[model samples]
Target: EKAEALGVPAGPERSRLVRGESVTLADGRIVHPDDVLGEPVPGAKLVYVGDASRVDDLVEEARGADVLVVEATYLEAEADLARKYGHLTAAQAATLAREAQVRQLYLTHISRRYSEREVLAEAEPIFPHTVVAKDFDRVRVVKQQ
Candidate 1:
């Protein structure tokens, strides 16, 4: 806007152009000129959450993530135990992924008391993209239009 303020105006004069000092995102996030842009083409975004019970800002933090790796330590039926242990239920993790709009949801840090099939069954109805993490399993996240 400096050009407009100073009446530098626009035309064939390349030098008259003024590059804004900052770029503003729709969410009101500001990007400085010196900021480092992450990822390359198709820009993948991954959010990793450990054994958290309830993270207040998790939804905002994981918004638009291509992949969200979070803990699902128990089934919804054992929500009380999950809360007692500061862990999340399978359904809770799925809800978080859905709210965050992540493309893929990987459930991890499961408790020994529960089976992977049970956890998967609890989450799949809420978020169809949910995956019950297996040891040494690998997944590639790619941005989609």
Candidate 2:
């Protein structure tokens, strides 16, 4: 909007400005580049892990992720079963998301013994952004300016 408002032509000059390079406007006004982006738009980063039981270096791998999708096949009550089956519990997935500093967490591949609410209950306390993923559910993470 700033570019449009300032009459930055919708071509090469605009492209340069978008790349964080200074560009002189048609009216001879110069727009300085911003370290964080002159615009509010930001690229998203998504990380998805399936059927994870071992998370030793997962935190470092998923650092700064905008969205994380991991399987939580059991509640903490069945933590032993989760470990035996090589799957994560809801709490485990949430903890992974928190430690990784991800913006959003989606728990998937849950066992039929528990409802979505039950899975969310165990995860939300550890990470407020936790969600029980559904089939074909699309998540879009937009950062605040």
Candidate 3:
């Protein structure tokens, strides 16, 4: 249903992209954690970037995102703990957003350890437009004037 709205082609090929192996997917392939895929929108495309092991790929995939939905589950104060958990601290995520030149960022998958206020306080400094996502909340991405 969502794909139809997005005009993404339906098929197994659109399910996931095979990493490490180069793929020649048509426009609209939706890339999964392991597979690459995209939805259709004329010349628009979606690329998949994997984990820290594939950090370069992640950066490339975020090249021109209007909004980047990123996870900043830890604080810089706990950098060691964050690395152990395979998560990024607020500073790291913000850096990525800035590097990618993303228009806006939405932070999610937050750790339950910090209160909402703490999360916002930690992230806001690193990324000026950052917001801590809450359950069942909706926010439209708006351009800054």
Candidate 4:
């Protein structure tokens, strides 16, 4: 009801669309998919990616999104674990963001075992503008400059 009041569709149009997922990294850090996406809040539309296999669903739903919040939970060395846990690494998330043509990409749901510097280092090579989310940080997404 609140989401509707703020113009977010009460439900996704596609039944196959994902709302979120959970996973454990090779380093033993646990992450829930929604944790990466911040909160649903009142205004934003959400299309969760429950697992990596659902990349197609993510791509389709993310089309034209002004802001795309994704996860880079692996370091490629742990890609096997990434697949096992259903999360994407920095490269994968950036690829999806590019393919979907989203205006901005915010990477989230990181393994807490890593420092903020490490996370940024892992994500920057792929997504130039990627920002690792910090608690209480505010990101304003307006349509245009």
The models' CA-based lDDT, in order, is 0.78, 0.84, 0.60, 0.63
User: What are the models' TM-scores?
Assistant: 0.69, 0.68, 0.56, 0.58
Model 3, span 1-145: residue lDDT tens = 5434444456543343322333343674443423333343343233222223113346667766666777777777887877887777766776776777666667777778877677778767766777776789775655434
Q: What is the lDDT, from 0 to 100, of the residue 52 in candidate 3?
A: 39
Q: How many collisions per candidate?
A: 0, 0, 13, 0
lDDT of 3: 0.60
Assess candidate 2 and give its TM-score to the true structure: 0.68
Better of 1 and 4 by lDDT: 1
What TM-score quantifies how close candidate 4 is to the native fold? 0.58
Better model by TM-score: candidate 1 vs candidate 4: 1
- On lDDT, the candidate that comes out on top is 2
Q: Report the lDDT tens digits of candidate 1 across residue range 45-90.
A: 9999998988566999999999999998888888898889999988
Model 3's number of clashes is: 13
Go through the candidates in order and give the C-alpha RMSD of each one to the true structure.
Answer: 9.9, 5.4, 11.2, 17.1
Ten contiguous residues with the weakest lDDT in model 4 = 9-18
**Candidate 4: C-alpha lDDT:** 0.63
> How much is 104 displaced in model 3, in angstroms?
1.1
